[model samples]
Target: MSAATSRPRLVVGITGASGAIYGVRLLDRARALGVETHLVVTSAGVLNVHHEMGLGRAELEARADHHHSPGEVGACIASGSFSTEAMVIAPCSMKTLAAVAHGFGDNLLSRAADVTLKERRRLVLMVRETPFNLAHLRNMVAATEMGAIVFPPLPAFYHRPQSIDELVDETVERVLQISGIGQASPKAWAGL
Candidate 1:
């Protein structure tokens, strides 16, 4: 919990993946839920956000409570003593996944993930790639064995989502709940 507001601190990482919207939406939903978010967006992540959502770095960073550069290895989130509740890499790219899986702390994002894992905190990776190859599968298995949750952001049809926004919101809600962050109104399954 954050010392200032006593709110749960969540570390969010955005990579150069296809579904940049997931990261942005997650930040928005977390903020609405009163979660303190520390954002780390890679250069490619910024480019993808601009291309997919037309959001500049400033606009994207504005959605979070704290923003850290990818190169800032000395950021607060890089240390387990910083006391983050969890870390989520929304739309986690194959490259970033590999880095985390291999324990490579080359950038602030990966370093924060390493810290989260070392602290035994929840580390959720919303891997975005489809039709994964053998290498991707191995990395995912390794990360899972190392206690990271691999969430692929697959849309649930049981909720009967009417629009893309609904689907995204539901997925973000699930992510929040999985990260131990409270969901405002979770859509629970009711058997017919």
Candidate 2:
């Protein structure tokens, strides 16, 4: 539909979580769909991305139309008026999750996510932690109750992916659906 071609604006937040590839995959999918993406990476997030995806700053930034520093408040995505369609904190650190859940907008990543919730736009937090304690669950619940989506980096075995990329693509495709792209960008699951 031409209406969907209006291009959704995405705010991607990369935290210091273990699985950084999710954020990269999200950016690539958005770019491929001609969606405008605003990328903001925390210091730990940068290290995680290089460790997981071997993507340098330039290469990663190239995947998005606009890139901002985690500390940069002037970034267009920091304001509630910026009109972002959604914000996804892929590989979202538990620290970041706790911060946003408690209204602690210390940096651009948290601030952007806060703005996303305030604007009633989609806010998907890919909580990248394992063995979640009660505290972590509480934080996630608080975020979800406040209109944020807490998607864990859990891979589904139903797809029977042959490689890591396929598994990654399947999860990333599901996340993309949250942004309104659905399976049209990545191969959709049509029942094998």
Candidate 3:
């Protein structure tokens, strides 16, 4: 597709995970790259954004090209026909992970992810939990088996990040790279 016609669209889902900043950063990056974004946030995600980033729902929704209600299962993104480059759940909660792993489409976020998987489009889950139990491990495995890329926002010290924002940016950069929408980054490793 030509540049004018091929604006890549990405579906971003934010859940109740601790690192709501990841989702925020992803939106900023996608916007900078001229990518269209469809965003969905769980109710718990709204609470976490307030608790963690002090951002209100309107502020968060304002960052995206379109925002879908969590309960809006009939939304355009819920269908496989919606042409998107990929779907990513930054700070993917264990609850969201379990729902997606089991094909649970209770909400628009999960339904969009399910549609992405079935349509063979890229689906990346930035699972934001630690101290994984057996169930979490199994859920990750199951999601991977179903063609989801389970990414944890593990800190990388090799770049010697000076601040938390740098770390978050680097992780977001990597996430975009995995989705084939990466931007040039100074932090990218040059290899030893």
Query: Which numbered prediction scores highest in lDDT against the true structure?
Result: 1
State each candidate's clash count. 0, 0, 0
Q: What is the C-alpha lDDT profile of model 2 across 1-192, one tens digit per residue?
A: 123336777889898899888999889978887778889999898888888788888888898889999879778788876776788899899999999999898888898888888888889999988899999999999999999999996788876789998888888888888766543354545885
Q: All candidates' TM-scores?
A: 0.97, 0.91, 0.95
Error of 1 at 20 (Å): 0.6
Ranking by lDDT: 1, 3, 2
Q: Which residue pairs show collisions in model 1?
A: none
Better of 2 and 3 by TM-score: 3
Model 2 scores what on Cα lDDT? Answer: 0.85
Residue 173 shift from truth in candidate 2, angstroms: 0.8
- The segments of candidate 1 whose C-alpha lies over 4 angstroms from its true place after superposition are none
* lDDT of every model, 2 decimals: 0.94, 0.85, 0.91
